[model samples]
Target: MSLRDAWDRFTASQAELEADDEQLEARRRGTQPVGRCHARSRATVSGVIRAVTFAPAAAGPALVAELYDGSGSLDLVWLGRLEIPGIEPGRRLVAEGMITSADFGRTHATMFNPEYRLLAPDSAEATP
Candidate 1:
């Protein structure tokens, strides 16, 4: 399948998994790895990219992007070789991973081990 098709399928499957309480609990219990969450949870996010900052000097090419998903907002950071393409304000994305709280004295949480797939209105596949 094409990348776009694969991404779409992945998102759909992920959404279903997230809705499963048993699955969510299993994942939370660490019986299943976070990477298995899939792309649908990320795709289901109703948010827009509020910021994008690069930190290439650190461990990897990291980008701190703020996303407000109506219900709440969270800082999404991509580390290592994960490349966030065309990130900007008003751009919406679907991100899936493990949500962990941060101890920075702020009510902040992180979606670790995330797998994101950008949704474009025109539906063009992201070139690798």
Candidate 2:
């Protein structure tokens, strides 16, 4: 690699680095980009889980995970679920569900109770 390329790589922000990695992995897995998914359509997205949040509601508890696929991020909400095995931050997985906009005017994408499969750690990476 050129010196300039090396310097750019070294100086890239954590989010940028992660986005690049997630995008590459998504392509390798042949999954659709989260950014390209539209509302009311079914999509399968592959990405690394960035964050997990739990919120208690009157009906039941909700577990929400933020998945980033480099192009964009999607919030996966599992209503009435306290927790699920292998659903955590930094883990890679593929999730499929109907796309919906969390806000009016279609800003952010969210999927409720998506079917998901946790991917094994990459051969070059250590198990989280």
Candidate 3:
């Protein structure tokens, strides 16, 4: 699905799902699921990589990417080591994931468990 379509679905479905303070807090702190987020969606966003952070744990590593589209921005977090080639600040990317509110506070939306595809400067289609 197109990015616009996905955003619409997200907004429309958001009101149907509810989460208490504890759940939101855990998701915000990266300790739990943000809410009752759906795993499948056709929506996606193409944006520039504004920031990247790596959170290492005993089990594995988690990568968080801050992406900004023209309308807004969202945090994309991957739970495992992701081989994202050509990933850097200023690089464009198309990501697929579920939108969830920040667990710490109602600051902004985040894309959890993202499976991203990098789009090259000259490539027509996105690549993993």
At residue 98, what lDDT does model 2 achieve?
94
Model 3 accuracy (lDDT, Cα) = 0.58
Question: What are the clashing pairs of model 1?
Answer: 42-94, 42-95
Q: Point out the higher-scoring one by lDDT: 2 or 3.
A: 2
Report the C-alpha lDDT of model 2 over 1-128, residue by residue, as the tens digit: 89998898899999888888888888888889998999899999999898998978778889989999999999998999999988999888889999997763224799989998888776423234
State the lDDT at 103 in candidate 2: 66
In model 2, what is the error at residue 50, expressed in angstroms? 0.9
Per-residue lDDT over 1-128 for candidate 1, one digit per residue giving the tens place of the 0 to 100 score: 79996676577765454345334433333333333323224322334566766657435566677765433466676666345556677675566665655643325655644676665744323223
Best by lDDT: 2
- Compute each candidate's TM-score over C-alphas: 0.50, 0.82, 0.55
Q: How accurate is candidate 2 locally (lDDT)?
A: 0.86
Worst lDDT window (10 residues) for model 1? 31-40
**RMSD (CA, Å), each prediction:** 12.5, 3.6, 12.8
Residue 59, model 2: lDDT of 82
lDDT of 1: 0.52
Each prediction's Cα lDDT score?
Answer: 0.52, 0.86, 0.58
